[model samples]
Target chain A: MAVLPNAGADALLMTPTPLADWLVVAPAVLPLLVGAFLIIVRKRLHWQAPVAITTLALVSLASIALLARVWSEGTLVMTMGRWLPPFGISFTVDLLGALFAVANSLIALGCAISASRRVIRSSRRYGYFAFLVLTAAGVNGTFTTGDIFNMYVWFEVFLISSFGLLVVGSTRAQLDGTMKYGVLNLIGTTLFLIATGLLYGIVGTLNMADIMRKLPLIEAAPLMTLATLYLLAFGMKAAAFPVHAWLPASYHTPENATSAYFGGVLTKVGVYALFRVLVMMFPVQLLELQTVVAWVAGSTMMLGALGALAQNDLRRMVGFQVILGVGVMMAGLAIGSAPGLAGGIFYALHSMVAISAAYLLVGVIERRSGSASLNALGGLWKDVPLLGAIAFVLVLSLGGLPPGSGLWPKVMLVQAALEAGRGWLTAAVLVSSLLSVIALGRFFLLTFWRPSSTESRSKHDGTPRVLGVLTVVAIVMGLYPEPFVAAAVRASDGLLDPAAYINAVFGEQG
Target chain B: MKTLIFRTVAPYLTALMLLFSVFILLRGHNEPGGGFIGGLIAASAFAIYGIAFGVPATRRAMWFHPIAIAGTGLLIAALSGLTGLFSGTPLLTGVWTKSPIIGFDISNVIIFDIGVYLVVAGAVSSIALALESTEDNH
Candidate 1:
């Protein structure tokens, strides 16, 4: 087999040289690389027992180490094989990128732990789990990669794995859901490609730093507009309301672990890309189009939340809720201030963690009650204390309650709206948050408390230990988020400073 | 019988297709061929093999879903772009070297080209695989 070029000179030479930063990049990517190898060789392996769990564990530890390194040091720049930027591919990690990359890895590890049982029951299931883990690898890697072309490449990575993950069951419903999912995402990706190619054509450089160096010098509204087209493409991938038909249909297609991991982590990659492009490479351009983004964000928030309110299925309701959060985060970005960006970033991080936990518990709900319908289930707290308690905490955090990470983000958004001097926008965000609270709250009450017609006192309280492990992690992250918060700040700082990025690439490589 | 295509031609076709896939990947950076087209061609070969023989026969010769190959390939390609962050370019800026590789332009775009080859190959192959699996189940 051909050896991966990941073993490049720059990547291999991570030291005082600019390439040292490339070390940070490996944490996000190493998993998929290893997992994909294992998956490809699964049929030949004698012992598949450790294949999923061991890889997930290792990836999780690597992600943790990556976060540790980013937090301890300001930002890490690891060029592959000591190769300079603008020439060789580098894996760079700022605080935000590393934090999420690590968090996503850990979350994925948790899901894999849970899915261990589910997979063993089905011989072909490990192949599917491998795909899911690979998607996580893609998710983490996409967030960390600073290159425009590489980002697009990672998006495709996620798409391919997720496509497989979503269609794993291949049931009639899964088939229909996946077909729709495939067509829409393929279209979105095509547009994303067009955007990348166009951006490259205009700038003649595909590196993020190079684009930043060149972007401020170029004077063309059409080029800027085309770049925004890519942002919109990414937004559609994030499942913003107008273009989000595939999410509600496809998310519920897989079993619970997937809805937990894939649903939770997938769209965040798109949102992360949007934020990276807007705040990092083209802030000036993004700010110029702020008004349009503002209105869109407000509308999206309202629409997604309302959609969530109408959903009757447990998974679909949470799926819509995640979309609603996307709307809120966009609104924060539209506000466009230090607090606004932080809030938006915080909300994004919160949603990724919260949705997965909610979905994981939904799986337990499905396992126990034999149904996930609002009409078919309830009295979870009376039956399963731990799941109920954990779900309560995670759902509340998602709902943006007091003293939680979600609340701080909303506070920042409020501050941002005021900063933009858009009094109406501020009110809209507040109103939207209120609407979300109501929608998610109703889902909670309906799913957790409202006694279904077939409400049973007996609870299958034996949630796999894996679910417990992830639930604990989510709650801990919710309680003490300083490390991640700091990481987000660093990522945002780097995002705002295109000059440093440009210098890294052009000065070293060019 | 359809098995005749399987018995004689399929084996030769399978090896030929796999070999061609590699050839396309190597030349992609210099030309229009890369991972996407290469992967697609290989997938088609597999599909042909699948039809002539059964999916099991085709799969027995191959391992992994084409999409998974693409996913990992996508990861590799994306990591290449981020390498710019260390050097201080916006993500995905290509660096060209006028250094004569015995007198020619050697660029990192080749890496990008390889990524495209894998992504296209993986995507097309997976889509085909998915459709085939769906039809077989039905």
Candidate 2:
């Protein structure tokens, strides 16, 4: 690819650096390579599980290293093909991006372990492992990339792999789910493409930092229009409010491992894109738009919680919880304050781990009981005390109960909203938490607390161990949230002030 | 049920199309022809072969499974990009080297394009084969 000359002389003068910047790209690239390797050897069914698991473990390590490097050294930027800024594709890793990337890899690792025990033999032979690794690469790429168009490409890469993963078995129900999932996501991505094209037309560059730097010079009407397009596109992707119909309709239809992976990482990619574009790229310029997002966030939280309350199926209920988490993140975005954004960021990290673990626990429960319906599952507290305990902790975390990771972020968001005089938002946050508690409590009472009706016993598997680790991680995050909160604060500081990012991307001349 | 005229012409047609696909793949770096279109052409050639003969015959002709071909292509494409890391450049940087025997310039870009071509052809043909075979079962 030819590298186009950037507008500024400073950008033009800077030459591409050496390969030392592999830290930024490796987290994404390593997974892509491993995925390709997996695809090639897919026929070797026996080795597929081990190879995929090992590769994800390595990817997890790389992501952790990337996160550590960024935390210690600030934002890391790498331009592809030795090209300068605003020309070559760049991968920028800030605290938020690195944290999410690390979380995504860990979730993939957990899901890979669970999937080895849970996914059917046929699916494994049909390139399921390949798709899983590809999804990780796409998620990591989406988090790390700095270019808007590159972000769109990463989203497509993510979408295609996830679509394949969703429909791997080609069951009638899976086909139906894939159709809904595919069509809606296609529309969302097309809108994102249009928005990217429009932004390029306006600013003549798709580099996010460049756009932020030039945002002030653009007209408000066009920027606002572009902002609305992005909100619609990413809102659909994040499963926020009106456009969230596809998520609940399709998420529960997939295998539990697939659902857990989607729950853990996919929608969050959309939410991350929303935060990156709407909050970081156009912070002050879109104040009115942010207010609108706040209202959407409130409705999303309320409606999602209500939807969860109405569900008897465990996976569907957890699916609605995912939507509820989106609203919480958006509320933080809506608050447009450092504390609000920090809360949103912290909540995002917390929910990704907790919600995914909940889904995996549901998978374990379904396996044990041979059904996912709450009515069919009973007296698990007596039979499988370990599962019951993990489920309890995950449900409490999902409900934003005290002594869970979920509560700290909610507290921060509520405090931020109240301080900002957004009483309605604060109420919305609290009321949603109450609704979540009711829904989760009902689920807990029916599934774990009630007397058993059948004498079915479940086979012992390694799946719960993966889930147990996740539960421990969540509890640790909940009890000692200082590091995560501090990371969020640092990330929010970056979001609020794009100058540091701009300077890092373009050097001192910026 | 196969027509005599189609059966007689299919082999030559497939051969011509395969040659044309390679031409397209090689010229893709500086011109309009590239991996995606080339792969489509190659897949169409096999599709015609399947229609005239049968799906089993087409699979036999291809030798390797279509998914495996696609996988190999993906591996090649990724490895071509990874080559940049060895040269002290960023990933996916197109590196050119002079062919000592041929005294001509060769580029990793063409290899990457070839990989893409194989992937598209393999993936498309695999889907077509699956659908075609399922029709018999139905």
Candidate 3:
């Protein structure tokens, strides 16, 4: 656990410390400490939810503060052991990372609140809160770390916690889901490890900024191989085409809140890594593989939407839509242009909030109507008008309809593709959006508009309040997108140009 | 497995191994032995004791759930890294003593290693005990 580099007393006296430095590591460290604490206090059912919620709320605040600092001051670097960059394990938060961290923490906070109902006493005894906080720590660590190997470590941390959460109830379906999820994800991480090892061997450093500075001096052939390996690995993690089976298969087996958390945060980590490594470290190689990636993006989008259209289970439909979202982001990466990357990042932020809310709404529907299958559910709009309105808002955002968070990014992506003269990619985006609308629209109409298929039992629930807030946030983002758009454009600029990132690590010292 | 002769010897063997594991864990700062290997040795000792006696006896002997031990160890490990903060250094920085205390080097580094030792031993013992109990049931 102690990855501290060698140092004497003299090294500590050189650099003056600041409050912002502590804030940079707060998102990762606070959750880990609180998670361990939760494990110790797992028996106190009353304490677990409150502690976890408070910690996540604190994490959200810290991440927002860090984001503000990074937005204004470029990148914030906090080197462990007081060692300088390239030697120490640096927690570097650039604008892209900071933005994602803010979103990650807020979504995690929402998920934790939802888990209050979703996680039962039996599951709580199994350390659900511990695993949840630890997963957040892993995601935050992945976002903040500048070292490539450290990112792999964070992946393991989260994946292990996810495994625990997946099999919390020891149900047969969950066990089967975990088996598939574990095997495929392990393969992906192994590939990532192999790629990291090779990149380290070639560049002689694992620090991303250092790699960026060194990769230009290396031969192009090996770099191309590395880029392809990364694409395959992160693509699998992001649940992109041909490697996305694990997501749809395993996601629906877990508890609804757990599923919501997974939907919100997990694949986006892969997308973030792709942005950091491909766009930042291997831009030339990424460009070389643009056509291949565009093909993958187009197919992933179409197949995911088509798969969603074929699903009757509500969460499973959203599961496929998760894949569809990944394909949209990949389209941005494949476009390899400024607007394209911005659109992808913006869409990612939008989806993290929208999709999580969608899953939570599904949970509420399941709890109220006692069914997750669309065929067995009907007339929610008449019975629960408020929930139907929330669902409508989520559908609008998720389907990229007007006046929702999801539309602006799709427009930017389509416009970027058109501007780049990729008419086929443009058509793919439009066609997939149309298909997604049909798929989700059918779900909304059947579940909300059609006559009741069965007697409904309504109960007092807290989920709508949570769902209402998220939908409102999504609506506000749609109604007022200027700030979000500016952040995305600036974040994409940081990715395309890493001079600020590099200097923040190498130059921000005594 | 619980034959009289084996059970008679098991207690002595387990005690010696536990003692040796402590020795290994203590000398890990500048030597070949460390928390991970030391923890493995200690866990094997517990596993032998569990095999000789029943899992219930072993659980009574430990007197704490292995997972709780592991969690405590994790908390200790995370907290140990904060020692650097007092000295105005970044987290996880090794804060060493100016001189050996009682002819032994004492630092947060050793505390961190001991935390690792507790985690490994606790986690391994739990897994082994669970497997043993399952076998007994079968």
For model 3, residues B1-138, the per-residue Cα lDDT tens digits are 969999999999999999999999988878889888888998899899999998999989989888888888889989998875565667787766645458754578888888888888899999999999998897
**Per-residue lDDT over A362-463 for candidate 1, one digit per residue giving the tens place of the 0 to 100 score:** 777787888878877777766766677777776667777754447666766787788779888778777766777787677678767876567474645455
Query: Quality of candidate 3's docking, in CAPRI categories?
Result: medium
Question: Candidate 3 overall Cα lDDT vs. reference?
Answer: 0.90
Cα lDDT tens digits for candidate 2, A1-510? 333334464443345546667878987888888888888888788888898899889988888988888988889988776567778787888888999999999999989988987688899888898999999999999999999999999999889999989998889989999999999999999999999999898899988888889888777448888889999999999999999999998999888999999998899998899889988877665588867988999999998899999999999999999999999999998998999999999999998899899899888888888899987889889888878888888888899986777989998999999988899989999999999999999999988889988886766665478898999989998899999999999999998888878877887757
Residue-wise C-alpha lDDT for candidate 3, range A330-443, written one tens digit per residue: 999999899999999999999999999999999999988989898899989988898998899899999999888899999999999999999999999999999999999999
- Clashing residue pairs in candidate 2 are none
Arrange candidates by lDDT, descending: 3, 2, 1
Alpha-carbon runs more than 4 Å astray in model 3: A1-13, A508-510, B99-101
The alpha-carbon deviation from the true structure for residue B118 of candidate 2, after best TM-score superposition, in angstroms, is: 1.3
DockQ result, candidate 2 = 0.49
Separately for all candidates shown, the number of backbone clashes (residues 3 or more apart, or on different chains) is 56, 0, 0
Question: DockQ: which is higher, 1 or 3?
Answer: 3
> By DockQ, is 2 or 3 better?
3
**TM-score (C-alpha) between model 3 and the true structure:** 0.97
Worst 10 residues of 2 chain A by lDDT: A1-10
Chain A only: list TM-scores of all candidates. 0.90, 0.96, 0.97
In terms of TM-score, how similar is model 2 to the real structure? 0.95
Local distance difference test, candidate 1: 0.71
Predicted model with the maximum TM-score? 3
Candidate 2 per-residue lDDT over residues B6-111, each given as its tens digit: 8999999999998999999877878889999999999999888887878999999999989889988988988888766666667777677766798766777888
